[model samples]
Target chain A: MSTAGESGKGVGGLSTAKRRPGRRPGSADTRGEIIIAARKIFSEKGFDKATIRGIAREAGVDPALVHHYFDTKDGIFVAALQLPVEPAKVVPLILAGPREEVGERLVRFVLTMTADPEAREPVIALMRSAMTNEQVVVMIREFLTAAVLNRVVEALGIPPVNMEVAFAQVFGVILMRYVLRLEPLASIEVEELVQIVAPTIQRYLGGD
Target chain B: MSTAGESGKGVGGLSTAKRRPGRRPGSADTRGEIIIAARKIFSEKGFDKATIRGIAREAGVDPALVHHYFDTKDGIFVAALQLPVEPAKVVPLILAGPREEVGERLVRFVLTMTADPEAREPVIALMRSAMTNEQVVVMIREFLTAAVLNRVVEALGIPPVNMEVAFAQVFGVILMRYVLRLEPLASIEVEELVQIVAPTIQRYLGGD
Candidate 1:
């Protein structure tokens, strides 16, 4: 299936793309290098200023190859951040279920995504970075608003504040459970957390 | 009230205590120095291991003077972290009001505490440090449990999990408002925030 980061001719016709000497397109970790470059550029320039050409140049690959792997700047940003789940994908999934149950679905999705150690690290890393780096926070806010919050609001007919508060609660749980690791909260069963937290989130989302 | 950092004669007797050469105990910012030392020690050792004597020695001040200014290890810790309010002071206030209004009181307390930029910075800094530093996380977890969460639970007669969840929501609001500065949530009026969030917190705290 030619996994996300393995040797293969580029999907966007970068088969003959020139690169720095001694590295073939088919052998080296082209995708990985691109992500590394994207991460650095994003950190330095934030989500808005970082560009495909810049990341491609930093990675020593053709820009087309960058596009082949990650279709848009947001895609590259998602890859660079190593997000647990794509906001583009998850927003739809969250919205697909009955509107009243949006809280349950949203809570379940995040808890499930973060339950795995591998899936959770990047988010924690991004959040930690966001705490100190105003640039990262702005980038995340823009990306999240664009990719997730705006879509949900448009589809569900809620004010922006509702989503923000709902997110704040979920964000707090993730921080408490994973980062701060406050007891009982940290070790509590996922079902228990969802049960306790979901109704409030529902109220925030769908309330009068 | 003597400003917390200002020089004053020790409340505890340390009139003739010896210290490292070149700094006078009565004339200098002894309280501030002890807090600096306490911050360093707490960073190095989790809450249980840090001691008043260790912080005093690190500050090149007498332990009695440290005791004079801040009466207990927890007091020193609260000062070192530059927390906006004393959990000790705040907890009792949160409990003193009608039990149903506890959520509103809590929401108001945190919103008011973090309203000041100077006050919020330390908390954000502590949260940022906690994300990367295991020692800091452990220290915070222990201290918060001792000074705040446990006390709230004991007085409210709710399961500890209820307080944890309530705290999680408040914690999330703080991070969202001050750190991430997510819009609507960040800029919403305090009264509006209290209205929207207090009910949920009240539910969390006093709900069946």
Candidate 2:
């Protein structure tokens, strides 16, 4: 995070860097910088208290530029947490295949998405925030509901509660295996986990 | 927290409250007070940093008395987290039933324990700590391993990894239901949850 952007001040140094008419789209670097700053502030202060201006300050960018790019704090959050394979895009892929295999698809998706460090950033950030802050928990719930979970339940035609239980079961496994790095669960292979966990998820999705 | 006990001094008023030879077995209330203080300190400062003296001060009791009752910081932690239904006692009971039903028993036990506000306090406290502090996570994992999980795995004669996976799945559900309060999972009935989750646990425990 850049230390130069003064805190709580109106768009001071940012006016010069402001987007010009027909100027090439702002570099993705500024957006990336803002995300890094947002990740830090959100984790430290949580969703309820993390201010966009604070994030902009940490990023050494103008608050107006932040507003221009992300439009709102929630927009910045959603962008920061945008998983490499957007859940909205992938949940359908998992659901489209054989109905009975939805559990395997869903389990595999989580295990695979989290298998790599870079791929897991958005999830880790969101999960950490959710664990610490009630507001972030609600925000994450809304995000997951909109981006992936509710859609999966709708397509499966299962009770939303069952899907939630299934999701929580898998979510818990990820928390143990990755975040907490608990033994056995942490070291188990993804395929092995899929075999063990997929059936449970399957039951929640399809079982009576 | 006792307001009478001043903070950050070398055991000020505690000298008078120091245990005496015939001090009436250190009333259970004092022990209880110490546990309450310990819980708050441990949660706020985490396992590594929370000092015995700090807990004693918060309890408004002598530090020597704290040591006399709990022996060590770890002992205090164990006492603080000891649930109403000791896992040592309950795991055997769960295992004594038909082996096939062991999963159901275990799943029901967790859901029921967490369903009650007072009973769930220790688990919730440890879970919240585990989520935030790496040291606390290790401590909680070790505690679970010693108190209940390893014993359950041994009694079942299943691969320990499978047992861990089963536990993580259920643990995850609790996190979602109570900690994160995700929809459907949060609101689902314990019986309904058992019906949905028990089979998965059964599969992990006894299935191929």
Candidate 3:
């Protein structure tokens, strides 16, 4: 499946439906283009410093068009970092599989989703922004808490803290591998890493 | 027991012995002061953009003084991030205890080192610099490879890749806890976390 197309289409439908004033009528693709620009600018300048006008200029659209498309920078960020498959949507798929393999599925999902640069950029952008900006950190924390972590914790019926620590370990490995490009970890085969990390993740999921 | 003094004294003695021209003989504390300033500037401006003159200006010393103390920007970076104790020095300390407990010691060392704002600043500075600057990433990768990681791998006799994976997990935990300050993980008590994480670290250190 075209994850990229799915991600864009999902947001595009939502924005067009909102039909905020000044959203150009014929510019069906305007929202998508603006999102592209937003991701770029936000990644470069981070969350706090990236201005709406700058994103609009990058998209070659007016500032009003940006406002029409996304109400606030936070709105744009939610849209920009939001992946094609929602955590809520994917969690059931993950949960439907064998109970014991959930950890492997989760590990493989993140590693595979972020395996490519095109798909990885938005994730990295969100993480990097969260790292440097306190405002963005809160927003991201709220987003993940709602969309991903909390859902997974509830599904497994595990302690939230345990799930968070599990996520932190895997999340850190991903950042080091993809973002920091740390050696050995960066170059190791995906399946090999999955094997090494999956068991620890399993323990985190259900271990005593 | 003063890590700050140890870090300063170690560098100062080396700088004075190098005896580069403009090395002010009377300025016994010049190396330490420059490191403090370097940590601040590198953290704020990042590694590639941070300049010797800028560091000197911040430290209220001459640019030549920075040059005398540190032969290159890389040198200052190494000195700045280099903790009070070297890995070579600490590896034996970590290895001297019960073999199974090494993981606990290593995990505790990193968590405790980064817990303090003053001690954590240089580490966070290096990590933040590494995140944004490719040059600094390579420099840091090399430093950790030689000074800490390689030594740990040697001591444990684990596959280098396994050792790296282990480090990445703990390293990521530290980044989230201290730098990003991710919730729950951030607030979780150190010993509590040590209990939660030590087993995983042990498995990485010794498990097949």
Q: In DockQ terms, which candidate is top?
A: 1
* Local accuracy of candidate 1 as per-residue lDDT tens digits, A21-126: 5333542467777899898887777676778899988887777777768777878888888887777767887889687898898898889889999999888888
Candidate 2: where are CA atoms >4 Å away? A1-77, B1-77, B82-84
Which prediction has more favorable lDDT, 1 or 3?
Answer: 1
Local accuracy of candidate 2 as per-residue lDDT tens digits, B1-208: 1222232234332445644332233553677678888878876776667789999888887888888776667667767776446565577887887878878888998898789887777777666666677767765676566666789777777887788778887887887788778787888789888887888889888745
The alpha-carbon deviation from the true structure for residue A9 of candidate 2, after best TM-score superposition, in angstroms, is 29
State, as a TM-score between 0 and 1, how close model 2 is to the true structure: 0.70
lDDT leader = 1
Give me the overall lDDT of model 2: 0.73
Candidates' RMSD to native: 4.7, 9.2, 8.5
Q: Rank the candidates by TM-score, best first.
A: 1, 3, 2
Which lDDT value does model 2 have at B118? 79
The model with the greatest TM-score is 1
lDDT of 1 by residue, B1-208 (tens): 1224343454324444445464446434556567778988988887878898888888887788777777778778887887777777667877896877988998987887678898888888888888888988989988888888999888878888878888888888888778777787889999888988899889978745
Worst 10 residues of 1 chain A by lDDT: A1-10
